[model samples]
Target: MSVNRATMQGAFDLCELFQMGGVPSIIAGGAARDIYFGVRPKDIDVIICGISMETASEILAGAGIASTPFHIYNGAASDRLVGGFKLVGTDIDVCLYDCTDVSEAIDAFDFNLNQFVISGIHHGIDGAHVRFVGEIHWSTLAAVRKDFTPARHDKMQAKWLDLSWRRATGEAVEVPVGGLDGPY
Candidate 1:
């Protein structure tokens, strides 16, 4: 789909929502990459930190979003899959996690945001401005060792390996994180 201003705005709105009340959330999955590239995302993945999975669900529910049951399959904490309203048809995946999980992810992941080059300036509701920072997720996962299915891992590895080869050949490289492997 063609990227547009509204797409970026939705992401900004979600970011604001989390910052104003959600607290300690990291934009992950598609939203993170899309925002970084000045595009709107089909889904917004908000990884919540600092609250119990149940408490996070309650908070999300109060905001008119419904929480999905916690599952061991997704490798996400507790997720809230939301849609409709002004964000109709868009998926808002809220992954609620504890503070310790967030900290550990930051500490262990080699591709974590803590190790990336982030620019402060970004597009927002008011055009180009310095409103948010681009966070990298791979390092965080590498640190935390959040596993995925092997098939998924293989697919992701193939992509990364391609990029790495390109980089070796003097081309720009974009890193990837999600894939199969782990307990998921």
Candidate 2:
């Protein structure tokens, strides 16, 4: 799959806006996975580290982007979200993490495929620049391309869960032999 130009442009716009506001952020989660597969993501997930929610809201509002408080519950805790906004018809979910750096934030993701991040937003006199943050596992690429669902980390249990859900859903799920250390 190839990236949808419109979808990527929207992500870049949001990243540029946050960068100008002095907030270091990255596009992670399912949005990054979609982009890797060249698919148009339904929404973009942006992760900001060591920033207050108030500051993030101010930055978005300054760009004429109004954001509403957004939350995601994992059945364990209520209100695990910070805020979300829309730009060019694409929903952008902003998450404020306690992480001190990008790698730490990436490590907190539930799924390997969702762990990849797109960061390093730079706008120069010539043009804008952005790139993926880490080296994705070859297995991750193969799994995505083959539509093979992998195990997800069970945060509460602190262990990996088998592909039971995928099997229940009739999806072809493959767990590489010896297991995977990171996103592949």
Candidate 3:
């Protein structure tokens, strides 16, 4: 399947935004991973390292984009919704970690984007792919595993719940696999 033109275009716009500023950004959440396999996320979540909160906000706000503040104002640089998604909900979240904090997290494990694999799914546009980016910070992943990971995992779980709800309502639909990682 091919990526939805609109969706892929938005992803490029997002990449361009960060590239212009020379910021190190990772396309996170389902969208990133989905890209490799040809699936488009309903929302995009991006992680930007080493950015100041003020600067992060300014960038997104300047673009006239809206974002959920939950990740922002929590010592994070910020999060922004670069564009809208029709299927997977694509939203980008930037977590600007201090240099010291990033170093500490990296030291905990030998991580890189290579550890991840891109898988396929039938969602949005056929053959649509998203960028999963990859896991790098073990410390942060470990800490988030306890809480945020569950919520992330819940994204996939909700699919099943949605299916069940649909069945109960006499609508038949098949649930798609979350991705190579099985949703978490």
Candidate 4:
């Protein structure tokens, strides 16, 4: 994907905000990838290693940021895995870090670019720090920069899945809260 300025600025601003808490945040999932390519992510997934959900919730509560358990999961209904929190209106989902380190976490994603971590992001998580898999496909990535192509269409379908997920979970889709909320 072709990097752009606005998205880069957004990543820096987000890092600035995260650093305010004085905690190391692992930017995971597709959000990391989007930030790498200078694409403003629809939602942000952050992971912290040393904090419990209760502690994290308390911190956010003290900061006036409403947070609740992130209900989205990929496994069976009976399985309770990876407790996380979703900050209301901010599109931020904070997950409790597991044994999987940032390196392994990034590799679990569907795409190469989605695999990354900007370690020790202080008051400034610059775009230059965005890491990725050793390999990259310029042509496929470039297609993401273009508008209304198959990639975009495929993304739209993926957005539909999110909408379905929300509906199934009794959650409402909102641009501020994170759903399909862009050109898609």
The candidate that wins on TM-score is 2
> Model 4 misses residue 69 by how many Å?
1.5
lDDT of 1 at 46: 49
Go through the candidates in order and give each one's C-alpha lDDT: 0.41, 0.50, 0.40, 0.47
Candidate number that wins on TM-score, 1 or 2: 2
lDDT of 2: 0.50
Q: If both were scored by lDDT, which would come out higher, candidate 1 or candidate 3?
A: 1
In model 4, which runs have C-alpha deviations exceeding 4 angstroms?
1-24, 71-81, 107-113, 123-128, 133-184
Off by over 4 Å in 3: 1-3, 66-68, 72-184
TM-score of each: 0.51, 0.57, 0.43, 0.50
Write the residue-wise lDDT of candidate 4 on 102-128 in tens digits. 444443344433444554344243313
Instruction: Determine which window of 10 residues in candidate 2 has minimal summed lDDT.
Output: 175-184
The per-residue C-alpha lDDT of model 1 at residue 62 equals: 76
Instruction: Return whichever of 1 and 3 wins on TM-score.
Output: 1
Best by lDDT: 2
Error of 3 at 4 (Å): 3.8
Q: What is the C-alpha lDDT profile of model 2 across 1-184, one tens digit per residue?
A: 3234455555667767776767767777666544444345567777776677677778877877756765444422222233444443456667776556656766555445565455433432123222234344323322222222244223312211222222244332222111132121
Candidate 2 residue runs with Cα over 4 Å from true position: 1-4, 72-89, 123-184
Q: Candidate 1, overall lDDT? A: 0.41
lDDT of 1 by residue, 96-135 (tens): 5435443333333223322222121133334332111224
